[model samples]
Target: MALSFLSHCLIGLCALSLFAWAEKECRYLPGDSGWPSIDDWSGLNDTVQGRLIATIPQASVCNSLPYGNYNSTACAELRASWTEAETYVTRPAEMMNPYYQNQSCDPFVTEKPCELGNYAVYSVNVTGQEDVLAAIRFAKEKNVRLVIKSTGHDYNGKSTGKGALSLWMHSLKTLQIIQAYESDTYSGPAVKIGPGIIAGEAYEALANVGYRIVGGECASVALAGGYTSGGGHSMLNTAYGMAADGALEWEIVTAQGEYLVATPQENADLYWALSGGGGGTYGVVLSMTTKIHPDGFISSGALQFTLAGAPNESSFWEAVRLFFEQMPSLVSDRNSLQLEIENNTFDVFGITLPDQNISAVQPLVAPYLEELTRLNISYTFTTNFSATYLDYFASIMGPLPYGPYPPTEIWNNRLVPRSVVLNSTANNLLIDAFKLAVADGTFLVGCNGINVADNEQRKHPDNAVFPAWRDAIASCSLTAFWDFDAALEVNLAVKETLVSVYTPAIEAATPGSGVYLNEIDPWYEGDWKQEMYGVNYHRLLDIKHKYDPDSLFYGHFAVGSDEFTVDGSGRLCKI
Candidate 1:
């Protein structure tokens, strides 16, 4: 009897030990005993039909010693193309922000050793749902960190992860136009875009069918991924609606590795969360079908002025004040304006007015133009009319330089409520905040009066897009940049200035407002859950727990991300 009891105690102790070992907080990392073996990865590659690729730092071709693929000619070509947005989008594991890349492999730094610092160690070139499923399952079973990437145009470093297995959705280029998509709530032309389809490709494809869709102004942004998932805004937002407002259905693979179609009538909660809650959080999006509009002419106007052209500093500010004052009226006319303010320079890249003639903008900008003339400020203004929205977009806002120019750039933005623009006191305060931001860094402001609240009926009433956006008249972004070789402290100071000084100033101007999730400061100091998702955050959290209870899908500042933290070694661990 004594021997039997001792044996039972030993067995129980062993069972407890195994249980404790299985519940380790951190995910398996390379060189860890629990990490997937060669045979395991080989099986996954076979499952994905040999699409698995060992990650090579994009700049590896520029380095000589570490990666060994270096060639002087290829390095030169890479250095030239590094500034182009297309260069990063085509390469798996290449992100727009080099800051997240940890300056591991810089094309310009040939002497430095190229390493896969924060980039994924391996990636599955996802071709379809099967590939996504295989990768998700493998990561779940192996307890490895997994991340998803599409076009790699993320501003907040959500697409790239350190020591992670990546699902590179860039290859899933499937595009189909629905001539007449009919549903209980929506009846219109729609487009089914694969997760990989970028804005430029979608625009061209839709234009060929004499239609257009509301997508990101930056042509390289993937239409189906983070762009739409984080409440995509476009030049056509005032006339139509935000990208989330057009989402009719989403075909996604949840964290449970179950394939599901989420629409208003079925899996409605999933649909709402996936619409604007955030991307790379709730599930892996396979494709999205969004409403498309008929092709229509767009009138574009451009304006430019510098301090040298102004009578005085005071006069220049007055002109800027007048421009902000006129925003409401212009937005009421269904116009969208993209403004860039740096030091003493103010450039209106374009004021896009859909379905209007070039003459339509004359009255809209008369007040600001008159103010410029009254101040004796010399300015240049031009207007052009395009045959279609696609024509105007392609001409003005096609692929531009992304990053690694200044090397690192961070952004913090606010959705300026319409009420603030209408109130004189608030408007001046808002402009003061803008001036302060410009005094510190750069501000790329998008002015529009989109009625997302009214337009919600076009798709569904409830979605996860921040409620503040529904009442916003403009989106103001504060940007800061640093050199590639800048020290960590310098980068932190730049981000801290935006967080402490600029963000608070803007937030004070637009009280109770929120920021665009897709283009937010990664280290936002405010209540990020509220700022990004607003009143819908709790509901979104519930949905997140329902779908991804294990917290398998984690991105920086993404929903449910608060539950986990990435340690110094970059292993994601439950807090």
Candidate 2:
């Protein structure tokens, strides 16, 4: 019994049966309609071969009962590692949704029911296309809200919904490598991956042979959902392109319960929307086939320095300012970098110089290093060369910082454009804003040098990725965290402050720049369509409305999401 709460579902089945007798169909409790009954749910479970799993409240916590096979000691360890990405993916309904297992439920005071907040009522642990089709059809017909989850590493709360039936794709881990994939738009080697495949799994599988693909930096990020669907950025983004740019086709089940294959030639509209349009809104993805590259060499390293003891912060700012000035030349030459600023310490990693070694990069970075030396800022710049991408990611990037369940953080990001980075006035404004954010308790600042999407290949697909991405020199983000026991108001205030201060800062620095949708605040009070998708928003809306007229699938920041609202009690209701 591998920590499964399903086997113990019998405890609630009897009560659900009583509720089934009182109701004949599934409906929203607030709509004066009956919710799904046990009988109705049983039918779905039968069709899916017992794959339906009940949402187990508090199952991931150590204090919860019905611990399955785990002992007290193991449960404690499990709780400690709840922040790890793998932990949430295994559970039925525990990802990205900050309110999960936090809201206080009425009547029940036990370890279990005391904290099942805003989680889906049930989840179909889908393993095949048929299961996805069945789940979609069931939700549409029964008037049940639907959500999709793949590894549950979402930052925008798109993977979970309240009182909904979710399709968990994490178990559908299938990876097939096509030695040569031929298509009208692209003809080359490719990999047809299940929507559930995470970055680490994909990389390990690809490295087993000799290939690489554009993907998320975090090992737990699922490639098919928020990653690729939101225009996946990678260390190789400057050299290759976004993950969406590499997408060739997708197998999805639509709101109408139709299983369709979307590619450049067929279902072209859906393909465009799925490529860079937000996930869990247009349709339910079953599998995605994307382009793959042959094994290649990359120069990678980590660099860091401290400015704490500096006579003035201006010198430190100048050192960072000089680095930004040199970004265009480095990025244009197929080089990418990620610089993390925490207080006075700067930690840089994921330094990718394609087809080059450590020796070759020394000259390019000499000017920046000289500037740092002039400021008397001691820096540690180490370099290494790897023959394969996997080796470089493993050795240079090392293990990613995965979190336990019930996360205590939220993120707000902006794609800083080249214009702002290069302009002296805008650059100073950007630095000042960052300083304000840091002073306000924003602990980490992540800046990644990325290539603009002005190349010929990016335009051909006509993707829904934000147009600003094509003009961006780097993606910048701020992370805000709070104590686990902090009040909801405190968390909300923190997020509000982050958005209020940073959004303006970023906007002033780079006017009209858009944010990376995947990492944006869920309660974003701005023009998301214009901010996230830019000119492509209208077309995305047309496709979304045409495909999901009933608003059957709605993710935060998705097209037409403004028509609905999440109330104080966490109920999603139409405005």
Candidate 3:
């Protein structure tokens, strides 16, 4: 009788496993029985006013195996223009990071057959709020995976998904300036910008009106989308605050297909979450209204130097250490620095000082210059002044390069707290970690001395920006790139070094600190929730559930993404 009972228990366990497998839930994919039929797609296209598009990989134009449109001349032009930011700007499925696309249609891989791989299967050209609503309702009704894209400038593959329906929001370019916008906690001039407005366009438009707003340093980053939602840092961050800090209201379409305005007073939770909680989580944003500051004369500085020889290696690090030490004082003076260290070269692209003159910058750099001279290091330094932020941006920031050709690059970032910079022992550890990190990839650092925690009026307590930013003196990113046609192991090895070696080194030096969500490693093996949102993750998750209970909008590493897993076939399935 006992043997019979044991056999019965084993049989029941096997039956339960089969039942679980049979009950697994996954979003519909092409070729699946549940996938929308051609008629269903045609109906959705009509609903969206014929803006629904069957996605063809942007690089397909260069490949004969994929869509058979290959022409040698066109392929050459496509390869030439591939690295330009504008190449992917208007393309519905193109993304900055091609690793997520599974190299399906890489322009450079002519030996392999080009396939759609992981690019969205379909997309809706979002021209208006109605389009956004139509896409949302269609995806929900059909149980199709949905994703959002604006400018395609995302770093962690948030804008693109495999076998999904994408809402391409690049054409909604509306910009309206409110000269005297009034709100509950503030009253000021604000600009209402469409989700499609890139940083450069917004800067130029605001400058034309004799005003400026905190925006991304990258010219192609969309102002109202993931940039702001990720707590965007800017050259003006030290002077004002983060990009999210300037936001006053958001016009969005919810998962339930309702159009609503989220502000400090109404849909308050949604407003707070959308402000800094990662984008593509809560709702589809249509436009964002943000506070604008009067345009003023801006002063900037640039410096560059290289390791003269092997003998100067120690001195080079010493100079970098000295520069890191001065970060606190620079922040105290409302100055921002963008520095890059790579291949034995150090470049300070710009030190932005708004509403000030070159004279004000001279004093701040005197100590660093003195150290460099003492170390017998040669360097180049220059300073300039501009009448408006746009002029300053044009001269100092310039257009950023778009790619590591087929887009095989990854970044890992950490926020260096003020305490770490102030502590001598900790500072040396941080510098040593920088050395180890730069050995594998480029090390980029942004030092902004703004204390958002102190500026309670500008950054509300409820805002979802990682709390670490409040105490951070600098932000550091270690980026690794590989050849476009490199083997899978090569890419995996690079990711391993970043995740296992560099990330831990930085974290050890700055314990309890968090990373910038916008720039973190997508394959990070750490406590991402704590690292990205800190103590705010719980609240953000709660809000995410409240607004999107079914988790319709999914992005890698976004809030509430843990509930689903991408299966072998690239289908998003509940875990």
1 versus 3: better lDDT goes to: 1
Q: Over the stretch 1-575, how does candidate 3's per-residue lDDT look in tens digits?
A: 99999999999999987765643478877887678899999999999989988987767777777578878887888877776677887688787775675567877777787787778888899999889888888888888889999987777788887778999998989999999999788788999999888888888888888998898767877889998999998888877778887888999988888889999899999999988999889989999999899999988788888887324789998888888877787666557888887758788877888899879887878788888888888899888889998888877556432212233357778889988878888999988888887763344433434445455334443688788888888777776664565765677677787788778988999998988898877778778888898788898999988888888888888998889888888888887
What clash pairs does model 3 have? 331-449
Ranking by TM-score: 3, 1, 2
- Cα lDDT, all candidates: 0.82, 0.76, 0.81
lDDT by residue for model 2 over 166-185, one digit each (tens)? Answer: 89997888899999899888
Worst 10 residues of 1 by lDDT: 399-408
Model 2 worst lDDT window (10 residues): 105-114
Model 2 C-alpha RMSD vs. true structure (Å) is: 8.8
Error of 2 at 138 (Å): 1.9
Please provide, for model 1 over 311-389, each residue's C-alpha lDDT reduced to its tens digit, 9 standing for 90 to 100.
8888887777778777777776467888877768888888888888888888778877888888899999998989988
TM-score for predicted model 2 compared with the true structure: 0.89
Candidates' TM-scores? 0.92, 0.89, 0.93
Q: Candidate 3 — worst ten consecutive residues by lDDT sum?
A: 399-408
Error of 1 at 303 (Å): 1.9
